[model samples]
Target: MRAVTVRPGAKDSVEVGEVPDPVPADGDLLVDALAVGVCGTDKEIARGEYGTAPPGGERLVLGHESLGRVRQAPPGSGFSAGDLVAGVVRRPDPEPCGACARGEFDMCRNGRYTERGIKELDGYGSEAWRVEAEYAVKLEPHLDRVGVLMEPTTVVAKAWEQVERVGARSWFEPQRVLVTGAGPIGLLATLLGIQRGLEVHVLDRVTEGPKPGLVRDLGATYHAKDIEQVISAVCPDIVIEATGANEPVLASLTGTAPYGVVCLTGVSPSGRRATVDAGAVNREIVLQNDAVVGSVNANLRHYRQAADALAEADPAWLERVITRRVPLERAAEAFREQPDDVKVVIEF
Candidate 1:
């Protein structure tokens, strides 16, 4: 079988190579890879910025957003031989801190959680991979073309979960949501917002492209102008900052909506300093009782919720999120994102 291999910290180490077929271990379920989504994390790993191979192994398989079909399942595993599934990426640490002890490895307090393709395990960017039954969640048959998106959606699922959790800190009924950026995460944030019956608005830098149309088609207002302009018009009760870019992050943090919730879902680069009014930001949060939280990775509950979200969404709309797809052989080129690309996937 062929797998995409990379030396974790070595630049230009990404390549297509041959590897042995998966030998299912006891209690392991075999999954035949269909397609894997390529996001910024994968690109960063390729550039030697971040990634870890299995202990003692030099090369790591390079994909985390995976969609696959079950090829073999142990008896009574709750999975069949043909079910479409996506694997949970993170695993609990050995110490199994308080959070991981409760099956919330996504919040491992000791910082020892292992993530497939990003931490210490091989990913599903190959012809096949073996996953524990508990880590694999079955998906609706309708998500065939867009199932690769399940991972990204799970991210926002957790973000929304936290937002609602904080909103419950007081009497809360959010009506308007401002999502910064119209990338995959931001769009999915908008989708979930609409599903929650909120008036959603999205802001992005691109003035023309499928993005404006995509947001508008969902009946959400799209803005490409200054962030403050849109923010003032909406006075959103909830803000989801999906672009880790400095300006948007600062704007969301400093928003003045009383009792509002802000979810920072983007991973911003360090050292990219921005001049922010820290006192004013603190004043807004303190005076208005606003809550700002950051969320990443998904636990089993979030994965299940993301599954339900995708199952209920229109298939046409879900498919539009994946703007490009290429064969496994051309996986390297898939990383070369075009100006208009939304989500890019590599078909195995």
Candidate 2:
């Protein structure tokens, strides 16, 4: 089998080459790779920003967002060969650790990567892969090719879960919400906010087209050209920062309404941190009771919900989100086209 690997400790580590095919163990399912989505995290890994590959492994496969078909499944494993599936990247061990006992395995100190073509675990961006049968979930037969993106969409779904950790209200309730930075995460938060009936507003310094159009199409108000001008005109009740830049984070805090909640959804660039008016946040906390929170990679249930939403999204609208489609061989090119890139899927 051919797989993408990051040569450990190499200056520019990424290389696609022939590797041993995955062999299934008892109660494991073997899958044939179909599609995988490259994420910002993958780019970071390639740049040696996220940390080296797991111990005792060379050229760690670099993919987490994936979709594929089952090629083999152990008897009575509850999945059959030929079943199409899309699953979350995290695989939790069933040991009775204190965190696992409380259903907080995502926070489990013992949790480790046990999936295909990932940083620690080999991921699904390959000719074939295998994993514990229980880790794979079957997909609906009618779902289209975009279903491969279930993994990234799961991040939004998981954020929704964390958003629920606080409290969520319909945007239609006349509650104004501001999404900072018009990147993929920001756009996703905007779309989810609009779907939930909020009067959504977005802020970003970049003067661009499709992103603003995409937000408006999804029923949110887009604001860029002048961020402060837009903020002054629209007082938002909730703020989501997804720019991965410090300025947006500070601006999001500045524009939030009294007693509103702010969700930090962006992955900060390496060695970067937001500098905010601490006095302002302090004043807001005392005067308006505002809140700030953060979210990360999703759990198993979020994977299912994200898939459902992606599978149900309007075909035309979803098609627009897909900026480009590149083959496994062009993975490097996909990374180079960052800056204004949206969804880039790597087909196996």
Candidate 3:
């Protein structure tokens, strides 16, 4: 099988080549790769930012957002041939921390979790892949073409789940939501927010692009100016920060309405100086009785929620999210970021 291979921690080594077929264990299900979504993490891995190969392996496959079809499944595995599926990326470490033991590997503590494509495991950027029966999720037949999006959808699903939980800390009836950075995560966050019947506003730098229209089509307001320009006018009740930029993150804390909840979903780079008044921001949170939390990754429950979110979304709108699709032969190009790119996928 031909697979996208990369030498862990080595820059500019991503390439497609033949590899041995996956070895399935007794209870494993073999999935035939159909599509895989490319994102910033794949680019980071290619740039030698951080990636790990499995034990005794030199190259790691380079995709985590995968959609596939079942080629082989153990009888009564709850999946069959031709079923669309996605492989669960993260696995609990051998220690099996309390969270992982409860099937929430996304919340695995002990810093020893292994994730496909990004850390210590081969990924699904290939023609052939396999995962444990319990770790793979089946998709509705209608989602075969768009299911590559399920992984990113799961990210926002988990974030929304956290938002609802955090909002319950006080008297909560959120009506407005502000999402920073209208990228994939931000837009998906916006989608989930609209699904909840909230007044949604998205902030991004581009004045014209697919993003503004995408937001508008979903009946959400889009802003190209800095968040500081309108934070006071709208007084958002829930702020989901997906920019990973320091300024917006700081603003989100102080800009929310009293008792508002803010969820930081972006992983910002370290060492950037944030110009803000720490004491004032603290005072705002304390005085307003607000809650701020961070969310990442997704467990099985979030995956199911993501599927439902996608199902509820207009199919045409979901198709628009996947702005481009490149075949397996042109996989490398899909990893490059483009100005208009909302989501790029590699079709096998």
Candidate 4:
């Protein structure tokens, strides 16, 4: 089996190498990899930005957004050997205390973030990876091609869930929504907003990025170099900040309409700390009643919903978000050349 192993150093250290293939246990299923999306977190981990693994694990695999077919299924797995599936990456005890009991696996005290082709469990970027059958969501036959996107889409889905949880209804009607950052998460949120019958608007600082055209093509309004201009004009009821940059997050806070909700999904490469204007936010809340919240990883329900949504959405829309597709062997190239790339999936 072949996998992308991270060599010690910076973001450019990832390399492809032959590794032992993962085998399925009694309750596990063996999946032949199809597509694996390279994420910003991958870049961060490679650059030693987030948590680090122990010594030898430096040779760890590096992908989580994946779609594959069940090459083999355990005797009682319930899935057929040929089923096309997209799986949830996080694995947790079905029973947990406090927050975890409410399905917040990402916040579970015993939850391990460094799992699956990451710092913990082996990941799915190899030619074959195995997992418990319960994690895989079977896709419709017609959706095999676009279903590979289920992994990232689920992320946006989870963010949406948080928006709704944090009183999204008090924000605005489904008619107007603003997405800050024309990146992968923002684009997907725009698509979801559109599907929910909202008029979507996307904002970005770069006047000439590779994503504006695609945003327009996806039926969302694109705003370049002028996020403030678009917000004042549109008065969007919902604003989703996906850039993870302090600028975009602050813009979302100031720009949302009174009583509107803002959801933050971006993982800032510069760590979680940001110097926000607390006084302004305090005053704004008193005057306008706006809400600001942060959203993170998905649970079982979000993963299933995202898989279903991707399976049903138009393939043309999916294609627009997927800027590039590289093989597992070129995983480093995908990360190194990420600035201009939208969503680069590592095809196994």
Q: Name the best candidate (by TM-score).
A: 1
Off by over 4 Å in 2: 93-97, 109-119, 168-174, 270-275, 338-340
Q: Is candidate 1 or candidate 2 better by lDDT?
A: 1
TM-score of 3: 0.98
The TM-score-based order of candidates, best leading, equals 1, 3, 4, 2
Q: What is residue 265's positional error in candidate 1, in angstroms?
A: 0.6
Tally clashes: model 4: 5
Candidate 4: regions farther than 4 A off:
7-11, 51-58, 93-95, 109-114, 168-172, 207-210, 271-277, 338-340
lDDT of each: 0.91, 0.70, 0.90, 0.75
**lDDT for each residue of candidate 1 in 171-209, tens digit (9 for 90 to 100):** 888899999999999999999999999999999999887
Ten contiguous residues minimizing lDDT sum, candidate 3: 225-234
lDDT of 1 at 67: 96
Question: Would you estimate the TM-scores of all the predictions?
Answer: 0.99, 0.88, 0.98, 0.90
**What range of 10 consecutive residues in model 2 has the weakest lDDT sum?**
165-174
lDDT of 2 by residue, 97-137 (tens): 67555645555576543434444566677778776766676
Best by lDDT: 1
Q: For residues 3-44, what per-residue lDDT tens digits would candidate 4 score against the true structure? A: 876643455667788888786677888889888887877777
Which scores better on TM-score, 2 or 3? 3
The 10-residue segment of model 1 with minimum total lDDT is 248-257
Identify the runs in model 3 with alpha carbons over 4 angstroms from their true place: none
For all candidates, the clash counts are: 0, 11, 0, 5
Candidate 2, position 37, lDDT: 76
